[model samples]
Target chain A: MEERKVILDIHNFSIAFEQYENGFKKTSLPTIRELDVTIHEGEMVAVVGSSGSGKSLLAHGILGIQPYNATLGGEIIYDGEILTEERKAALRGNEIVLVPQSVAFLDPLMKIGPQIRKGKKDKASKEKLDGIFKGFHLKEEVQDLYPFEMSGGMNRRVLVSTAMMGNPRLVIADEPTPGLHMDMVRRVMAHFREMADNGAGVLLITHDLEQALEVADRVVVFYAGTTVEDADVKDFEKEENLRHPYSKALWRALPQNGFQFIDGTQPYVKDLPEGCPFGPRCKECTAECKKRIAYREVRGGRVRCIHAV
Target chain B: MRHHLLFIGKNLIRMILLLFGVSVAAFILVSVSPIDPLQANVGQAALGSMSVEQIEKLQDYWGVGQPPLQRFLAWASDFFRGDMGISLLYRQPVLEVIKVKLANSLWLMCIAWVISGVVGFVLGIISGLKKDTWIDKLIKGYSLLIASTPAFWLALVLLMVFAVWLKVLPIGLSVPIGMEASGVTIGDKIQHAILPALTLSITGISNITLHTREKMIDIMESDYVLFARARGESTWSIVKNHGLRNVILPALTLQFGSISEIFGGSVLVEQIFSYPGLGQAAVTAGTGSDVPLLLGITVISAAIVFGGNLIANVLYGIVDPRIRRGGKRS
Candidate 1:
């Protein structure tokens, strides 16, 4: 088969914030360190991490919407071109869309229609919006209502409709299904899957491993602000097939796989130890694991652990 | 339709009650004041030389011999019939004097109010959008300085500079000296009003500017604004679409609330300029103990302030859809 075009290739991505310490002392906190994710045309990639692991930061960093104090260190290659700040600005809403995490992201004072349309009043745009809203089961009268006047489910659908309004080639959904019921979660996931089926690159940043496995073709596991493994979804069928120790542990902790958990929590970014971030909690940790570990390929999958074969 | 009508009716009743309360308060306070309307209006020597019958006639004419409640009742009854009584000091009908004086003050006040609101709102938006920069710092410092400065002091300074030394504008009054109402030009009225109106405008700008600046800052930092930026909206577009709507409502509320402050400030400003506006007339009535004229001015000014607030409340419904849609939150 012919190789699919790489739509988004993010390598060694890291984000650090310039913060004030005690008495005006300045410090740089590396919240995301040496993360990597790549998605091909028509592929759905999920970056799965728990809260504070900086999964959302990756999405913001890719879109160039990081906080004012954040400093980025990485090369985000999109459609074979280096994604500069200007390029991100140019392609943000037209080519690359973000389905934000919450209903609060919608402007409270604005009407639903003009906001989704980004104030576009052309006939083609309006017609496209009508079709998209119809598909989402939103009525014509709903367009005139405010976001606060709608249910959470309706607002969630409205956010999804924003991505579809424009012919977006890359859709970055950041924790789009938190606090949602399983049925609603599946519905939102299917909308994203449809986007991918239409040949767009969809990057879904989620914390639920089961949800990620349900819709994503590939999963990148984040541990302590780093991607420890990048494996195919089929690799998660058994714990032994996973390359990284953390990914194996995650698979084993799934309800169908005995719900076993490892000891110790992920280290805070400020107190991360030398070498492997999971070293202190790994039963198979050796003195060699104290050195800086590099991400390398092992049996057609990427892993950060030296012991993985 | 019924909801709107009910809202208006409720506010109208409230306005009547408010005016009544204000009139009674002004009457009681003026009655207890030691100015002695008979002595203030007529000379002290004239009072002593008057015959007993003449003295009784003067007391009765001034309503000084009647009980406070009875006098108030008499005034209220006459006021309800559109009769504001006669000004003892001006020797004219109280309503007629107020109408003429109010016309003089209205233009001065309206000019000041418009200039302050427009200029302050634009400066506030610029300062907030350029927060933490030199422009923001400069506007903040200017607003603070103006807010702290006394209106009378500013008025005096402007008068000294423009009228005393510069000799560019008229020193006082609404028109050129010795000019008849028929002969006086609009240009002459404006020139005389410039100093007093400038004083009022300069002082009024600071409150709205600072308040709008604070609100704009809050809006710029909100999550929706951030999302707008992420949606590829230019900074100007975000402000036009999001920031303006959020901040304008609060600015309007502050704008109307400033009316009373403007009316109060006009009193001192008019006194300083000697301009024959309602504020100057109010001062003259108070010092001369023209009870009828003072009471008339009190009722009118109270109505204006209350009316401003009522208009603001009504406009809130038109401007904000959340309020307009009426109490249904999902």
Candidate 2:
């Protein structure tokens, strides 16, 4: 219960970018719409989504890599303090590091040692990173080798080392174990679990539900850029408690659960349904579903489906 | 070290082919010219009185009477052995004439080379790291402006502005044109080279600026750069350590591609400043149709090109390890 203390509190966050054309008229595309999400210390939150679910955009928001042209509407508080631009740069790489998808994540031309040592002057960063590299069975000599010289496994280890070098409180991994072998996935997942145990929040984003089920304490399922389901991993296991029609449908759509594929496409943000974004594709849809966005809460979880109550 | 050597060997092969192609074209162009050096040596008065026997003998002496391949091979062999014959225009040993000029040109070129290379590379990285920001826009504007303008035109403009308007450096001549009795000392000669060297560098420096900036932008988008950022690396570290190094890959590999430009710049700069350089010496040889002098200059130019490209290749191979690993795919 003490661990539930908020590490990040993002409220009503919206981001829009202006596009210019035809000699100067500009229009905005609102990507994130009133998104409210939070993460407590030592938590593992798996962001579940299909492609283009705005998962990466959320990561960009947290890291402040969102372009200057982007108009952000919301408060992002880190440790009870409003996260400003100066804090964003300072927090990045040390306070909230990222582990992006590709194994070739380290610079192909530079050696690992100097690359890892870069921009990090703090104590916890250097020591913990050195420990992780040694713990991962990666040799110290590898610091001299270029990214291309390292094997896929070695590169994976080196990437984890570099991210941990900052000893960040939050580690956002976008499909961390994608394209990796099954053996490597377990090892990577174990590393994430160890990180969370050591007081770092691990935000692992992935489309692979089974992997998420393995390591995540809780999960937030994104549908059409909206969090349709937020619940403990156990809440996802119960057949009766799979309350959201979308969540139930998603549960049914799992290959292991005997369904081949989900029946329809996600709702377009621009041409979204008046009520639930999933209403168009939901088998339990009714005429009343067209009036408002779905919002419902089960005993131990929340879902954005009207009929779920 | 082993990989480095292997890359050097591979690069040497490529340089040899490139130089061979260039040398063949140069040989044909120089040989088929309208004015023959032997005829050039003998004025209009001697031309009418010269016997057919003497004319053939003169042609034979210059090896023009022999088959093209034979003459080229003989010339290449002797040229490599430091026997480039004599200049018909200067009436001096071709080696003796070109040596001092080549030395001076090399010195000026070397300085300009270091300056442009270092500054362009560092600026390129900075621009890429600040992509889409005002800093990036400013560098992009500067690079484009420099790249699009012609070198000689830029030279004249700079001369008028810096030398005439500001009076910082001398103009038109290299080191007191009278030729001091002891022949202008090394230090004075260098002081005289400033304007011409700067004039020679405009295009090359600009080209380096644009090219490195563009290349670094491509490198910044690379996965590794993203990876570096993900690792919590600072902007400066990413730009310097990651962006610049990878961007320099193609630059390193294709380095010899610019040697011809440098030599070409030297030719123009020499004429503009009236400084005595091997490039202008070659031009003087060509205009006067000095056969031995012409051959010597042509051969030496080819050799310098060959040598420069060779160095570029060797250095490239050292920087890029992939070339050493599989030999070709990289």
User: Residues B1-330, candidate 2, lDDT per residue (tens digit)?
Assistant: 686687678866776676556657667777787766666666667867889898777766655556767767876677668688776668688888878778867877776666666666666667766788898899778878877877677768877887789977767666776786488787777777887777666556666766777787777777776656655567677766766667777666434556767787788777766778887787887766665676666667777777776677667766776655336434
Give me the candidate number with maximum DockQ.
Answer: 1
Candidate 1: tens digits of C-alpha lDDT, residues A1-309:
468999999988899998889959999999998898899999999999888899988888988888889999978999999999899999888789899888788888899999888777899889998999999899998899988788878978899998887679999999999899999999999999999999999999999999999999999999998999999999999888899889989898889989999988999999998999999999889999999899999877788999999
The DockQ figures for the candidates are 0.62, 0.57
- What TM-score does each model's chain B reach against the true chain B? 0.95, 0.79
* Best model number under lDDT: 1
In angstroms, the error of model 1 at A240 is 2.6
Clashing pairs in 1: none
User: What is candidate 2's lDDT per residue for A1-309, written digit by digit as tens?
Assistant: 664778887766777778885759887766666455667889898988888767788787888876568887788999889998778778888888888776566666656776677735478656665687788888888877766677888867777776776657988888888877888999888988888888888888898777898898888777776777777888767657777766676677776777756677875556666666778777888998887554456767777777776
Candidate 1 chain A weakest lDDT stretch, 10 residues: A147-156
Candidate 1: residue B239 lDDT (0-100): 90
CA error at residue B183 for candidate 1, angstroms = 0.7
